[model samples]
Target: MTTWSAPIYVYLWLAGMAGGSYFAAFLAERFAGYNQRRLTQLAIQMGVLPAVLGVLLLLADLGNPLRFWHLLAEFNILSPMSMGTWILLAWVAIAVVMNVLYRYEGQHGEPGGRPIHRLNGGLGWLQFLFSILLMSYTGVLLATSNRALWAGSALIPPLFVASAVSTGIAVLIAYILVVAPVTTGKTTEYRLPARLLTGSTEWAIPTRLVGRLWEAEAIVILVELVVLIGLVAWLGSSAMAGAREALNMLTFGALAAPFWVGVVLLASIVPLAFDMMSPGKELARREVFRVALASSVCVLLGALFLRAVIVIGGQL
Candidate 1:
């Protein structure tokens, strides 16, 4: 049996989850209506938890969590880990401020409820910027390592971004399905704020939002697949046979089943099919909800698997 270290897996999982959740919140806030405040709040709460935990896991792996403070005291932009730590701190700070603003606005309730609209707008833009940083840092963290398999791959950052976006969509879909039903009793016509989350309503979603999100996810997944295939092919052609063999393990070895079946087919392809089907105006609400939920779960699993395979392959 191959002995796996729990700390490494924990780091990978937490980073992906944190990155994915932030990306999801950022996107929903940009495109969705009235629900932006709620979604932003959710993003802050959800994103912070994973980030904090992931950092702790990384510290634990070092065997002395207190030593982590030393890294903060010393500033080194050239170091990928150091850069990532700074970025994470910025992201957390911005997210917290945004969440607080969102809460304050929610409490007042009106066009003139709060006077921080301009500040909120600025914070929203800052949130998006930090989100991109957080998403890309995961790939940078791995790529900077001396490991041959992880280094020299410029595709890693984009791949991480794509995975983050795909996973974000999945999280949004799941959130909507679970929470949208409760809003049926709300008499007010839902209007999503500029920085809040939104969902399909009255048993039907706006065609534009649903269609756009699905299309974006499809493109991201396809691009990710292409990158993975190209990377494998390149590795095979190189003199590093060990690296090539390790990459192949992802396709034909123990990780093959999850990579091919769970991540590729079930997560990307199946969801694409459902999106393409467009069950129509007459489709049952329950059926639509089920499809969305299932696709979300698959995407989440795929995101997790991507990091898992990479981390394991590096070890091999």
Candidate 2:
């Protein structure tokens, strides 16, 4: 019997999240004019681990793990798997180069670093493009399958992209909160009364960008929320029985608890509510970071749950 296991789901989640991280970091550093140093550093760090880990997981999941090397030897422009392998290989090389160049400039304090940095920045565009393709390829890989649940709708790729971005922002936010220093006396801190009606008493007020980062996270989360709604709606309306079954599994089947509580409630809504608590205004930086950290954790967990549910539910 054919089966997709936990490792496959993990590979999918990691690949998407990594692609999202690279794309998010690239955009922030390139066009948004954010803290290029920090963003680039985060990008390279985030990209490398996932790129390596995803491949490892993929290999382990294969029945014949050693056969993985054949991917490089094989060349089929028409094969999604073959193309994805090439993209993955290229992406890893770019990530390593970025990491090396960034660290070199930092250690040597090279005055000529400007031109080198510029060249590296130019490569960032390639990273972004590869990221987009890599993220979409996950959905395309599944959709090309004969499985009705996977092939029923054209929205999977876009949905995956949105989710990838949302999770990517979460990962970046967590990294920033952990690594970046807190600004002292930068803004006044204030707290609203806790929602007694809702049960919890903790209050949160968001402060904008420790420089320009958090704001971007909020924007991506919002976009993901919108795309998520469309994804569900599209899937629900799909004429295929497998699609309906898959949707049912998510909404009211064995996977319901994890899908709703883990993915929908904790992952999507909670973070969204936290971000909306204070938008574009400066408040307590620590408090904002705390809330953002909480959101990031939830988003990451939710992202993992999403892949598990989709992979398993589709088959059922």
Best by TM-score: 2
Off by over 4 Å in 2: 182-212, 280-284
What TM-scores do the predictions have?
Answer: 0.80, 0.85
lDDT of 2 by residue, 1-316 (tens): 3388788888888888889887776776556555444554566667788879988998888789888888889988778778888887888888888777666555444586777787777777788898898898777777777776667777667767777877777777676566444444664422222232112333222224332555666676567667667667876887876767777778898889988887788767887787786564233456765776787888888888877877777777
lDDT of 1 at 30: 66
Best by lDDT: 2
Residues 1-316 of candidate 1: C-alpha lDDT, one tens digit per residue = 3233556655656665666666665575566764434555555656777777877777887766778888789779878788888887887777677667665665566576457656777787777777787788878877776555667457667777777777766665565555543334523122233233222222323334543555566677777778777667766766653666666777798778877886678756777786665544112255665766676787778777777777666667
Candidate 1 achieves a global lDDT of: 0.65
Candidate 1 C-alpha RMSD relative to the actual structure: 4.8
> Ten residues in a row with the worst lDDT in model 2?
190-199
lDDT of 1 at 240: 56
Worst 10 residues of 1 by lDDT: 194-203
In candidate 2, list every pair of residues with a backbone clash.
Answer: none
